[model samples]
Target: MLVRIITGIIGITAAAFVIQTGGVVFAGFTLLLMLLAWFEYVRAFSERGMGIALVTGFIALAAMWYAAWQKPELLALACPLIVLVMLLESVLMRGSTSIMDALASGAGLIYIGFPFTCLLQLRGMLPETVFSTEISSFTFGCAFVWIMFIGTWASDTFAYFTGTAIGRHKLCPSISPNKTIEGFMGSVIGTTAVVAGLGYYLNLPLQEMAVLGLLIAIFATLGDLVESVAKRYVGIKDSGNIIPGHGGVWDRFDSVLFTAPLVFYFVQFVNLLGK
Candidate 1:
């Protein structure tokens, strides 16, 4: 437990430092994560003898990064191409006559592609007005990402401790045996306090902060649950044993996978509403 905590803190600190520098540092880190995650996903499915899955996965990851960086406007042009490639690959894969396998490949692309794209979009959308004045974009982006990470980490931390301490009734025994309603509520409350406090300290509007906190708390829980369900379906305990204490890349990113898109759309929605 101590090792995990120390490693997590160190990992986060290094990530923050890289994000603070932005430009190549930020892009390189993001690309590395995207590739690693893609490889992991491909490896998982390849065990089922699904050829070309790795190729499709890497292509999707690259497409997302490119879309995020150079040609978001090209998404209209790119989505069809990706679908076509996947469809053709599915046909070429031996024994892909099963509709399920084809669907799984398509689902993997969407699942991995969308959130990966959102990370780039979030970085792209860093408010120039906020960053240009007094604060650097890198600093602001790091701070924003840090706030989101804090919410996720706090919720996970509180839920684990609280669940172990006062968990009497199961929340979803079929999906996650250890989870309890009490733990869920504890996580919500713990994360909300931290998120709201951070917003207040940052001088953000109270109502907006509260709303954002609520959204993060709710969505983050859902994200964790979603990953739990996936793992259950796949008959795995941890995604991978990448970190000493933490699970795999998927385990570390499960919550962020869902939260990234939510954060991106929320920011966009807020900006549009304000305008």
Candidate 2:
């Protein structure tokens, strides 16, 4: 418990510092994380001796990184290529393998790569009309991203303590035995509180903050379940033991993987509605 709290504090602090720096620092850090995540993901599938899985994983990562940085145009081009490659590979390996391998690889790419890239894109999507000042725009963009992280983390922490203390009903025993309905409610409440506080500080609309909080809570829970399902399928307790208490990079960012894109889209939608 102590290890987890310490790790969580350190991770949040470091992430906030890097995010506040913005520009190359944030981009480079995010890219490096995505690459490492892709590596771990491919390594997991490769253990089952699926060579094509690794290839497709890297291809997906590369496409995502490129799309995040340079050309959103290429994503359309990349998606069909990924689909074709996966289909062809599945056909060629039909006699030798199960379709689960291909599905796992594809799922990881969409699960991890898509949101990671979307976050990068979010950083780039600041409105030129809002500010002539680059620093102000970057700071505003980073603030939105930071709020998402803070709310998600608060929700997870609340769920953990509440579930441990008072959990009686299993939320999804088949997927994650430890998760409970009490925990889910705790998470929602915690997330809502944090969202309300941050939204007031940032002057975001009350309704938007309420909705964002709910979405973050829902997506974060789903993300945790998705990772749990993956680990259960692979017969592993944790993705890796890199962090002393957190299990792995994926373990630490599981919620972020799912919530980031959702938050990004919410911001975009709000911006559009405002105009």
lDDT of 2 by residue, 64-173 (tens): 77876788878767765676666666678877545766666666677777888878877766634332233344345677787778888888988999999999999999
Q: RMSD to the native, candidate 2?
A: 3.2
Error of 1 at 124 (Å): 2.7
Clashes of each: 0, 0
lDDT of 1 at 215: 75
Report the Cα lDDT for residue 275, model 1: 43
Q: What's the TM-score of every candidate structure?
A: 0.87, 0.87
Summarize candidate 1's per-residue lDDT along 1-275 as a digit string, tens digits.
89988988889888778666666677777777777766666666555655436666677778767877778887656666776667776567646534556666667776767776777666655545353324443334455566677777887888889899998999888888898998888888888788778666665555666677677777878888887887766666777777779877878888888777876777666642234
Best candidate (score: lDDT): 2
Cα lDDT of model 2 overall? 0.77
The true-versus-predicted C-alpha distance at residue 81 of model 2, in Å, is: 2.4
What are the RMSDs of all candidates, in order? 2.9, 3.2
